[model samples]
Target: MNLSDYLLAQDGHDWPSLLSDWAEVLPGDFIVWIVNRLGDLVVVLPDGSVHWLDVGNGSLKRVADNREHFVSAIDEGDNANEWLAIPLVDACVASGMALGAGQCYGFKVPPMLGGAYEVSNLEPTSLAVHYGLLGQIHRQTKDLPDGTQIKFVLSP
Candidate 1:
């Protein structure tokens, strides 16, 4: 599948619900592994990979953004799967590269009154595409290890 398909497959409304549900099931430390995506808390691995849990279908998609391009889930119109195409944002690539491997970049969504969802882990590829398009780059860092102890922070 491609990145666009993966993003479209996601039920935007489920972000908050998943976050609330995960907060109950996840240990406090594990919360740090969770990456906020516009209020949706996605589990991110140390390799800069992300897991999107479909609350509606109880399914999961593991995604990795390597700056150059992305692959996404495909709907075959049956019990099958195909691949979707998505391009990366250049800025996102620059940011991801700056952040180094095993790290992700975060983007802020303008505040919505009384809404819980605000920021999201910018898809590395998407960010790359954005950055590449605009020829901009953002500051980033790398420190944590795979399965390293983590703490939930409002900002990365």
Candidate 2:
């Protein structure tokens, strides 16, 4: 089967189905999969890489920085199910696999539950900062394309 065939088999919001399809389609050397607090699916490659598949109810927007487009899906009022796709993410994973790299890790952030008006003891801002720090650490330690590093932040 060709790359197009693999891409065609994937569904945008179904995480498990998508993952299974990805594994069959690409069968890369390494696949580090993660299910975050917000139900977002993250896949990291052998080269210490990460990619976020937005499967949450959020608003997807393209942020322009340094002449490049960075896609972000933000969970906001009313429209909480918006989704975003990491462009060429699958290709990157397939390429890494073809290169014979092998190292995969999967992690999941615990879910946060509450009504819109309820304020939790944990500050959302602080949590964001903590995740941001973790993303930075991953990037510095892993050798991936520059644009790929920022992709983690936009993930769930």
Candidate 3:
């Protein structure tokens, strides 16, 4: 896999180096390595879904259902300090998705507040909604949840 031109500038490191670093991780099983926000390791699965390896807990968290949604969410998200926007956009463009001013699509945030979930057992529709793609969703949060909200995109 090659890093998009836009992505190459975002992180300086090339695809080979990134892949090498990801392979060094224990129990390596990532198809495509994205970026590491702080200690959170972001990777892409064989099916094109995005996941984050929580180094602190030694767990993998679903970030997006697929690359498309991942790109859109990151591109539209706060990128001033978060350098993930360009990389995400590059990933999508590299995948051959035509994204620009009015081409990109957005999704609604998922119902689950925050925290990570099993990548294998995820609700695709919920993920789409969470990314702001589907119509508005109301969860009526009953209790005070823990941790920040996880932003998952893509349709399952």
Candidate with top TM-score is 3
Worst 10 residues of 1 by lDDT: 109-118
Global lDDT of model 2: 0.30
Instruction: Report the Cα RMSD per candidate.
Output: 15.9, 18.8, 16.1
Give lDDT tens digits, candidate 2, residues 28-114: 643434333222444544554444443221111222221112122223332222222222223334444221111111123311111
Error of 1 at 68 (Å): 5.1
* Per-prediction TM-score to the true structure, in the order listed: 0.23, 0.22, 0.31
**What would the per-residue lDDT of candidate 1 be over residues 48-117, giving only the tens digit for each residue?**
5545432212234654342122223223242122111122233334454333332223343211111122
Clashing pairs in 2: 57-80, 57-81, 58-80, 58-82
Clashes of each: 24, 4, 12
Which ranges of candidate 3 are over 4 A from the true structure?
1-28, 75-156
Pairwise TM-score winner, candidates 1 and 3:
3
lDDT of 3: 0.40
Residue-wise C-alpha lDDT for candidate 3, range 33-109, written one tens digit per residue: 65332223467777778776433233456767887777666656463124333444444445555433212222222
* TM match of model 3 to true structure: 0.31
